[model samples]
Target: MTHSSVPAPSPDQESLFAAAAADYARYRPGVPEAAVRLLADVLRGRPDPVLLDLGTGTGQVPLALRHAVPGLAHIEAVDVSRQMLDRARDALAPVLGRCTLTLVHAAADEYRPPAPQPGEVVRQPDLITCCRSYHWMPGPAVLAMADRVAAPGAAVAIMGDGSLWSHDSEWTRALRELIQAYLGSERRAGTHATYTEPRRSYQEDLATSAFTDVSEYRYPVARTWTPAAVVGYLRSTSFAHPDLFQERHEAFEAEARQLLDTYTRDALQEEAVFTVLLARRPGTAS
Candidate 1:
């Protein structure tokens, strides 16, 4: 089913995750291992390669890739939410000593590559990764910014599967309906943002951008979730964030638990096909 493009959350709307940062860190799934391997291959022979990760929520992508690519020299992780960045910092602590890490609190499109310091040489980033959160960015502008800052052979990987609320599974269907019943039938995102099905696909956006060479890799993975985990994950999402319920938060949870329990008894597994859309400049090797 076609849904609206997830709009970039405005200043006020960006506050949606402010209170849910902790839940976000604890519940959001890790980047697929296959995706990390693909990224590692891109930086394989490059010396002291730097990675620029946009919308680095909880720093999950970097955390997952640290062991996969021990030679990675640095990472610039940018996000607009201070709360999310805080949890990301904590989550990324293990790898801080292994690689230079810079956490920038700025919108994806507003952040620029860091300037070089005296006697210190800074090379363009070798790889860029945006997972799950690219929908929150201004697509064309961010792509343009990436093209301007990337190294000669650099590639951009935009990765995501639809959120649980939008998945087509039976349980997810009921969960989405429950949320709609509470927050109105329209899907809610960020604070005031509502999802509008995009007229153009992300592939189309990249095809017209400076990075016109693009390919997609899909990994079909089955995941199991408990009732509590499902509810916790919901709290981390923009559409079903707890604040939307306000005074009814506790009451809503009680009902949601009852609803989820019915499905978790025998099976709580769903097949989520994670897709990584890799885009590179015209002359870059894929």
Candidate 2:
């Protein structure tokens, strides 16, 4: 397709991850506990703190932090994809515990909590988090929106680790080469644009936002994946979505399985570093 003719990401993103929601829910790793603890540390004393998790794919972050935050009474898990929200709803329903969950279908900038009627209270989110999905959003705009709706001294935490496609290893290298042969050398981003690194870093973006004070924490994560899990994970990625493979998907899977077999007996190794940036408005308490 010509550059001018190429589609930009749609506002709703309703169909972006539609085809691979099942695999996404299954293969995407959960947010780590130490990250949750650091996020929770920011809201340690807030009574009945409300959490607003942005791009909350399958409700993983909020689910991980359900009881981590002090009296985390209500959670607003927002996503643009209907399929992911549905999966999140299903995954969170049973173990809600003391927290009430509200699944919102919205782009980050479009999300606003319910307006309080006369004599009612509209409690703003104490912590706003976007994990592994913030780059997909309009960063400045989303942070501006958060400034409008969040409580005084509220924190915004953005978290992510590089994906398997981005990791460097013999198996991942072979896998990337295989995908490049089928697709292209450039990375595919969520159905529309080719992958380009964000011009400004997250810290730089936050530096300009209302949340000026930023602290970054990195946690070491070691993982081993079965070849089947690797295949399933590939299906869920924007770079290697099943739609990109078309009729050759099964054939590719067979080749990927066969290729992974030579890399090791069964498991593929991953050593990743997950990072979280916890930010707040200037003068917000620690």
Candidate 3:
């Protein structure tokens, strides 16, 4: 696999994700049921196949896909967080014995294809998936790696940036204010309250891998939560300011609670809807 030209997230940012792992699993919503259905369509008719899930945070994508593809024989779920891996292991225990569920603890960029021994040809995976975690790696690196790790006709799916919500939503406005106040100028430039733009080249970048018949899908789904749930969800984000300052953390929590109550009519509700991009490698035996 060719190394990605895109740089990984900063060590401090990565640490934030690691610290937020538990909260993320507790409050972070799973993949949408509709997106899972789309993945089922992408993997339909494939024989007992092997799958590699890049950036398999807490194994949500694998869990969702396994539900759709019950006949899958093997799945390798990789992530960088030990805490996240532990949660994934616990969540996937029921199917662990049935299917080969290998939980690899490593950053996606650093992961390498298994070395072949004498007289042994490594088995390339039939399907490769990058769920919400693709943004962490450089796009060029991922495409190059996919070319090397996936079989000739393998299917690769990149699903993320599907978050589409009302920019005018009160919660959105409050969160923006809170981010600006708490993060100051350090907040990512051009970042909006909603997931609007594509973070990377979707079709063109993946096409560089020489995959044929590329396609994309967008699915919309929503989840509602109360004020407390909103707080929990906010704590799950990598940009969460809670851990940075103890006193300020308490103050932020109080402010968030009040803002949520005011905006959500004392209920504090928000929803997230996203699109899933589904693509395939050329020469797939149909």
Candidate 4:
């Protein structure tokens, strides 16, 4: 299992994510109940502990975890996008007083602990978690940053890079045909048939690293969306060629509508399952 380096989001990609913020908030899948339960289990005895959520886009993971673990007090939600941070703030407004929502506008690579004044020392978090955003940073850099910001015995949990949908039984054949027909040979050869093993490779890299007590878990989740919702999701994609092929984009949407019509007549239901990886820093004694 070889983990490919996570690439930084391009300017265009950032624009797409920012533009699709509403859809992302509405249609973006939630963290699986199983994954949320695992996170709660990890933080079971720690009350009012400080937890940092990296790449906290629209604050989905933290919100989900907050629901699962009511005892959690402080969550520093960090993301590079101001628009994303704004949306997250709006979403978590009700609980903003109970929980400290610090929205940091900085890239993952350049993020740093707030500088200590005089003789003061910066405090590391008890737990640091990232969901669906770990793939946005290079693995080595993220690991190093995690090591620096997490206190001894703190946990670093990540869940995503699971977007490859070609593995699912229902869409595999159809997606393959669509890719072949729409994407030319140059791009077609680079695509993966499934996302499972590639995601596992990333987990294996973390598990084998010096980070102690590393573990992995897989959870399944499904969502039902109308064709309009599906189109919204597609619009959010970094690979979507909307500007390059305006006419083709319309055609592809029409084809997708037809496909959805054939499948469900009323609405399209897509099921996605993801693997979650949890790793903890060594205890102080170690």
lDDT of each: 0.82, 0.84, 0.67, 0.64
lDDT of 1 by residue, 1-286 (tens): 0111123335673586677788889988887888889989999999898888988888888887777888888888887777777777787776666687777777788777666678878768899889987887888989998988899989999999787876788888988888888889888876677888766788988988988889899999788999899899989888888878888878888888999999986677778999999999888884
Per-residue lDDT of candidate 2, residues 1-286 (tens digit): 0011012235527677777789999999888889988887877888888898988888898777775764788888888777788888888777777777777777877787765569966878999999999988889999999999999989999999989988999899999999989888999876666888888899889999999988889999999988899999998888998888889889999999999989776568999999999998989756
Predicted structure 2, TM vs. truth:
0.93
Clashing pairs in 4: none
What lDDT is obtained when candidate 3 is compared to the true structure?
0.67
In angstroms, how far off is 217's CA in candidate 1? 0.2
Q: Pick the TM-score winner.
A: 1
**How many residue pairs clash per model?**
6, 0, 3, 0
Q: RMSD per prediction, one decimal?
A: 5.2, 5.4, 4.9, 6.1
**Poorest 10 consecutive residues of model 4 by lDDT?**
187-196
Each prediction's TM-score against the native? 0.94, 0.93, 0.83, 0.79
For candidate 2, the 10 contiguous residues with the lowest summed lDDT are 1-10
The Cα error of candidate 4 at residue 245, in Å, is 3.8
Lowest lDDT sum, 10 consecutive residues, model 3, at 188-197
What TM-score does prediction 3 earn?
0.83
- Extract clashing residue pairs from model 1: 3-197, 4-196, 4-197, 5-196, 5-197, 5-198
Residue 98, candidate 4: Cα error in Å is 2.1
Residue 239 error for model 2, in Å? 0.8
Instruction: For candidate 4, report its TM-score.
Output: 0.79
